[model samples]
Target: MHFFFHGQESLSILDWILRAAVIFIFVIFTVKIMGSRAISQLRLLDFVIALMLGNIIAHPLSDHRIGLKGSVISTIVIVVLYLLGIFLSLKWPGLRRIINSKPFPLIKDGEILYKGLKRARISIDDLLAELRKEKVEDVKKVALAIWESSGEISLFLEPQFEAITPSFYQLQTEPFDLPQTVIREGRIDFSVLRRIGKEEEWLIHTLRSSHHTEINNILLATIDRQHNLQVFLYK
Candidate 1:
């Protein structure tokens, strides 16, 4: 009786180990096949695939009689179908268009497209909310608004002012435009010299006046449009 009990206990432990191994293998295989994007940025198709994969794996785990071969076959079939869908999307432009529809133009030439809003399944309230998020109080200020493929809204604003004419070109001996050095990390930029109409000698003299002995010590330096040298020290 003691020997029989020991054999039964050993068999039970072996079965448990086999079940665990099956689950581990299936989980790893499914996750790998699904790709890294499954963890984040889940799309509609991705969500459906994930749900189906979970159900397939659960069935084998619950029923020991299902067999590993059947589970593997089902997983492969699902993966193949997913790959085929992706291939169809790429190979056929029309099918791709059907699967991932084009962006709907919500605004054109400062006018709201009500037809686009209906096609996108969004209401006027929804559009107003989106415009508010973009900090646009008036629709007239918006040059264009497009509902992107990712379900996000993109807005383009009209220029603030019109271009000046030749009549406005009056020269009053203003200081020449200076190139601002918004970023610097050690090396002297020759591009900046050409922009400010000054050579290396002028830059060296400017640095010396500011008590900065080396260019490496300065983190950032800028000459504004007004030709004022602004230097920031490295920390």
Candidate 2:
């Protein structure tokens, strides 16, 4: 990481200036060409390529021996090879399949596939760890677990365990102000009433209008954006 040093004279002034431009372009090109797969997942090949590039580029910048031109050529060739891989992967589906690993199921229908985990090179503990990251404490809760090609675990929980989303009911939502609890557990939250610019008299009048004359009868009451005070009476 000679590119990250300070107060060192490993190379001449011109050498530093020239190599900086090359390094910048090299990094930009590699990252852009590799796509999010290289950044987020970082397959074994990508990791190796990145490490090689760092060493290859830094060596020439650090000493007068390895010469800047050779490093530049090495960087160019590496970038070219990567670009070629992308082009060929696009032209030929079979080659693309070879280059990129497909998602493999680690768990199917709540059963842990030991053989699948073995083929994926993932240990039982590692599989559990990835599950834990998704807040899955037990494999029994998982309906399916796929080891993604991007080196991440994709978890699918049983239908009963999945959270109910708005889409489930086909309900649409509109923006609304946060509801303020005006009463809780048969206690009048005067602070909330005051903040919402209402007094005890107003609360009593509103409750009476709804035939709920007594505040102690309210187990919970909240004021919504529409200034509607929805009250839940104590049983």
Candidate 3:
């Protein structure tokens, strides 16, 4: 007693499920080919594209009146647009700025940026929740808090409120020397030696004096202001 479109049966639940699976696979494959990142670090525009993916599927899956082919085409179009935006952003800094917003200072030197908070559309409770994630109980202890465009929060504490180190006890602290690895997995870093104003001959001589005739036997070696040629040999 019932009639069907094009003399074929209306799409069933199984048909809908299969169509959804195919679309999902297609979307994932397309994203992978584009070298897209995971959703967690997604920017606002990226999140919107993700939601568009769901939007394309939701209606067709629920309503038999909606065509699956139409949904698939629409989803592809949206994805292509997203990919284009990503490409253009890389080429043009202006476009990149539009896509990824500038980092807003939520806190500066223990002072809250109320205007920025409002612009970011986050409540004080939301800000506190983010701080709590960093294990910061008191806002006054924080020196800087940045609202990154990627929806990540960065916190910096004042030096006075920073972690207690051996230097805190007035121990003989070495001058600030960037800890550079001079050797890793038995490979020497000649560039690091040049930066530290040391010669390859000096390093070879030092290793020989320490009874390390072969650089390949060394697992790690570091040079800093406080020490010279710290070598860790393989067991």
Q: Compare the candidates by lDDT and give the number of the best one.
A: 2
Q: Give residue 187's error in model 2 in angstroms.
A: 42
**In model 2, which regions exceed 4 Å deviation?**
1-40, 43-45, 175-235
List the candidates ranked by lDDT, beginning with the highest. Answer: 2, 3, 1
On residues 60-169, what C-alpha lDDT tens digit does candidate 2 reach at each position? 77887666765666567666666666788789999766656667899998899998887677689988988888988988989999877566778999999899988899
Clashing pairs in 3: none
* Model 1: residues with Cα > 4 Å off, grouped in runs: 1-44, 54-72, 161-235
Compare candidates 1 and 2 on lDDT and give the better one.
Answer: 2
Candidate 2's error at 16, in angstroms? 22
Per-model lDDT: 0.67, 0.74, 0.74
Q: lDDT of candidate 2 vs native? A: 0.74
Using all chains and alpha carbons, the TM-scores for the candidates as numbered come to 0.44, 0.56, 0.52
Error of 3 at 147 (Å): 0.9
Number of the predicted model whose TM-score against the real structure is largest: 2
Worst 10 residues of 3 by lDDT: 1-10
In the range 27-87, model 1's lDDT, one tens digit per residue, is 5456545432343334434554576678778988999866565456656666665677678
Model 2 clashes, total count: 0
TM-score attained by model 2? 0.56
